[model samples]
Target chain A: MYQNPRAMPSAFQPVPALAIPQGDREGALLVAYANGDPEAAREIMAALAPRVLAQALRMLADRAEAEDVTQDAFLRLWRIAPEWRQGEAKVSTWLHRVTANLCTDRLRRRRRSVGLDEVAEPEDPAPSVAARMQGEARLRALSDALAQLPERQAQAVSLRHLEGLSNPEIAAVMEIGVEAVESLTARGKRALAALLRGRKAELGYDED
Target chain B: MTRIETGADGGRELDDLLAEARALEVVPSAALWARLAADAERERPRPRTVVPAVPPAPGGWRGWLRLLGGWPAVGGFVAATLAGIWIGAAPPTGVSSVLPSLWGEDVSVALGVDEDPLSLLEG
Candidate 1:
């Protein structure tokens, strides 16, 4: 659905979001929410959900599971609005942490029944439409490899390489030091290379 | 059999894979948004609905009396009460004669240790 960012009514008028840069959008939306602009919630829901949902999908490897994690994370952002100490942390970093923690919780629960099973192979049969997308195959392979990495390493890799978060931002989301974030991502990248090396030929990595 | 390209080795190939993942955008379905909107509405504290205090419509006797303010009305009220007490406590001869009947003869007897009606007559 096309949500006209302005079509969403606001309880109080806000400075328009037209000039908001990518990094500052969530913060702007949050400030609007705190100031009682109703539209801010909708804008935040639209802007952040896709990113959060995508991250959750990568972390959890299930669409339903990812969507649940996204919902919970946004619900929490709403709940914490009044006391959201602005500038203490970027809203995106804070949300990434929440979604990560939630995914970790579900991962733990699923682990009770699922032992050492490789999580990368897509459980769903490739629909003809999706099968045409080579990127989807690469993502599936990468996700399976990620599942094999240690939890923190997987998270570090997802945040750094996949999510494109900087090391410091990854540290904030993982609640660890920047050095640790660096170490984890480095280790994760090495591990992924070793895993994917054997499959590159099969997955058409050199179609050219 | 196909081989994935890396600038150098496997590490470069993984980097290319990571780039694909980064560029990948997964927009959530509208139903998910609807669910969130419902939860947001359910969870949002209702706006306090401040019943705008109709500014008391400018005085029913007591308010006008209050707006008239401190000294004049309040002081007059206090002074009148004090005067009434003083008159009741110690009335002059002619005033005392009429007051006893207004108060009833029992009030003089009731004044007891605080007053002696006979002593006032001597004054």
Candidate 2:
């Protein structure tokens, strides 16, 4: 269904390929690192760490935890450098998958320990307090709704909608077929819409 | 890219909120970068330095030294050869008296040969 980018709206268009390092480059860098090249290690980290951390932050909504997840993901990358098979997956996709799993584990633990209401809102560095509060509320609400989703659905929707990845890219990250990705994202969006519609007033959306 | 499916109620609002979330770029803090770099450095594989148990033996005749138990054994062999040469060149008086008797023993008698092998060739 997602094979044709032209058929989709511009907003659903694929992210610019140049924005991310190609899988081949990442794979080569990892091989270089395995061969004891420090520059390769630095280059790979510079290319991938921020995105990995951002994905973690989007899922966890906590910077400290996000940083931890990012670090853990990179450490795994470092350990896997020698064994990483190129062409199998993009480094970003692998890292995102790892980050998602880590975030899901933490979210599950947090749920067991504390109530969703007790989950702290993210601190946004917006220019004004009102904007910052609004940003925080939106993130907090989205995170809460996402937490309510099944793990795969949350990951698929986040990768598709928030990260702006193509269906094929989401398929690679989630290790599922494109049809499964479409099914999950569609169901996830419907659930998110339902959850958010109920909170339309609380989230400061105009009641039409 | 904001694709709000207007087909669903409040889809536009959801799309807007998601667009805003996407815009909420979480630039990794400098500290996070430092931490990652540190992790990369700490976890990088280092080249191994292999040290030989014995210093490499030199080549040619010197290479033979390894087979003959190295330089020390060669030195000992050289010393023994020189000692033999010196002893042969200048025997002690007591050794000279016994030298003739030592040489007097017939090779044919020693081997219990009835006749010399060279004498057979002559016949």
Instruction: Give the winner by TM-score.
Output: 2
What are the runs in model 2 whose C-alpha is more than 4 Å off? A1-23, A119-127, B1-10, B48-53, B56-123
lDDT per residue as tens, model 1, B1-123: 112223443366677777777766778788898888877666654444568654454658777666667458788889999998988788779897886688767632554454655776785
Predicted model with the maximum lDDT: 2
| Clash numbers, per candidate | 2, 1
Q: In model 2, what is chain B's TM-score? A: 0.38
lDDT of 2 at A93: 79
Candidate 1, residues A1-208, lDDT tens digits: the string is: 6476667666555546666667678787776676666777778777678889998887665778889999999889888987877677788788888887787677666656454334344345567744545556566667667666777887887787767787877888888899998788778778768877767655546633
Interface RMSD of each: 6.5, 7.0
Residue pairs of candidate 1 with colliding backbone atoms = A120-A144, A201-B2
Model 2 TM-score relative to the real fold? 0.70
User: CA shift at A135, candidate 2, in angstroms?
Assistant: 1.2
- The candidate 2 chain B region of ten consecutive residues with least summed lDDT is B1-10
Model 1 residue runs over 4 Å out of place are A11-25, A31-36, A109-112, A115-138, A194-208, B1-13, B52-123
What is the DockQ (computed on Cα atoms) for candidate 2?
Answer: 0.31
